[model samples]
Target: MSRLLLLSPLLLFLGLAYLLPLSGVMLQSVTTPEPGLQNYSAALGDPLVWSVIWRTLRVCLCVTVLAVVLAYPLTLLWLKGNTATRVLVELAIMIPFWLSVLSRAFGWLSLLSNRGLINSWLQSLGIIAEPLTMVRNEFGVVIGMMHFLIPFAVFPLASAMRSVDDRVILAARGMGASRMRIFWQIFVPMTKSGIVGAALLVFVFSLGFYIVPTLLGGGRSVMIAELIYLRIFQIPNWGLAAALSALLMVSIGAFLVALIKRAGVSTT
Candidate 1:
């Protein structure tokens, strides 16, 4: 009872700061432009809206996959390394967190553009006659998003890997378990929670990403969040924007619930 009382303030703060704003946004989605289900109907009926949503999902999926693939090997290395080496690797990962997203996006643009560093070097080496179309497309978006998301995936996985006792692996080896068998039977299962958590985090973050996709993707790729922005700021269609925002929130919620269930089952 005392602990519950102590947490009441935090709970109240969340209710006021988080829940209230979210409810207001939801309400606005439904109530705006004469208080009907028209906005939701429009959202469902519009093919363009569906396309944007699908694109957002696709981008998020790609980013999550890339982040997880890269993170797994890095996490393993970090786990096996000495404390000083692990700290250095962690610091390298943390460097991106200090830089702004726009800066990083611009950095990617510099490297990926036709007249950029890669093209210049390749041209000088006579590797190709013309520059590659790397920036302002899906390729650039994926690359930029992966850069941002890899650290997110790595930290959780490394932490989870660290939590897994080294003794278990030694015991399995001592019992004559093959390397592949031990990894599949022990390490993979142990780190499932971290993988799921990292994937969820990356997916959620990428789903709503605006700057990376906008700068790198050009007009070829349109994410739901960007569409929502266009509706609100460009087209001034608040009702539709709110509806799209609500849909994005719902989708994110569903993914999070699924992740929680998977984590629960794994733990059980």
Candidate 2:
């Protein structure tokens, strides 16, 4: 009775703020246009809906891979770095989290625009007479997502890499193991839990992304979140909106379950 009382606040909050609203949306999916599975069936059967899902998955996977590849190297360097170097690297990794997402999106816009810094630098070097299209494309979307998610990958990876014993690495060095062998064999295996956890976090977050894809993508890359926004506001189709919301929730939950089972990693 005491334990239940202690948990009542959280339970009440979830019930009032989250569960109630979620239940309304779920109910709306079936009840809005004559209660049945028709909304889901129509959503699942649509080719355009499938295309959005595929794009979401692809961009998310790309961001996760890029973030992991980039962050893991920094994680390794951080592990080997002196205190000052570690502080600098930690600052670099964490500074993004302090900024607003909208601000970051606008910053990327300024950098990746045709007259932006990168293009100007390239043109000054006689690289190309014309500036390449960086913003309002799939590449731009991935870049935006990566900037935001890199910290997620790094923190988990840093925690995982710390679990690898320094003595084990030294032992491998003493045993004539090549640096490449040491990394592939000894270092990689030790950080599996962190990597998997980070990947799951990245992929799941990317699935629900709205602002980056909307702002950077310029409607060229329509993910589920953008689609939901359009359905609700532009078209005023509550049934379709609710259906997409429900589908997104189910898909994310399913992927999380499969990933946890495959990796045998616990979030706890």
Candidate 3:
């Protein structure tokens, strides 16, 4: 009873800070423009909304796959490295996180633009007669999102890999198992939880990403989160915006739950 009383303040704070704001958003989304289910109906009925939602899902899936593929070798290297090497690699992974997302998007914009660094170098080398259209497209969005998400994927996977017993790998190797076999049959299975968790985290983050898609992708790439922002702030369509926001939240929640279930099954 005493401990419960002591925890009340913390619980109250969480309720106020998190749940309250979420409830307010839900209320606003449902109640605005004369209330009822009109906003939700509009969100569902609009083909453009569905298209943006599908595009968001596709982008998130692509980002998750790219991040996992890139993070794996880096995680392996980090796990196998010495203390100093580990620190250096970890710092390199974290550098992007320290930078602002907007700044990183801008950096990508400069690199991927027609007259940007890559094009300038390519032109200097006579690689192409004209610059490539990398920026203001889905390509730039994926590249920038992967850049932001790789570190997130790496940390969780590396931490999980570190927890895996080195002796297990050695034992498998000693039992006539090749390195590739041991990695696939043993290491990959053990690290499945972390991989799923990281993928889920990256997907959720990418789903709602605005800066990378907005700055790097221009008008060509329209993500759901960006659409929601425009609806609420630019067009002042709070009802529709709120509905979209709610959908985003629901999508993330579903992903998280599925991930947790998979993790549980893998662990079992």
Q: Which candidate is the best by lDDT?
A: 2
lDDT of 3: 0.88
- lDDT winner between candidates 1 and 2: 2
Q: Which whole-number lDDT from 0 to 100 does residue 168 have in model 3?
A: 94
Task: Count clashing pairs, candidate 3.
Answer: 0
Query: Each prediction's Cα lDDT score?
Result: 0.88, 0.91, 0.88
Stretches of candidate 3 off by over 4 Å are 82-87, 265-268
TM-score of 2: 0.94
Judged by whole-model lDDT over C-alpha atoms, candidate 2 comes out at 0.91
Rank by TM-score, highest first.
2, 3, 1
Writing each residue's lDDT as its tens digit, candidate 2 over 123-231 gives 9999999998999999999999999998888888989988888999999999999999999998899899989988887888888899999999977899989899999
The 10-residue segment of model 1 with minimum total lDDT is: 259-268
TM-scores of the candidates in the order shown: 0.93, 0.94, 0.93
Predicted structure 1, TM vs. truth: 0.93
Ranking by lDDT: 2, 1, 3
Residue pairs clashing in model 3 are none
- Residue 56, model 2: lDDT of 90
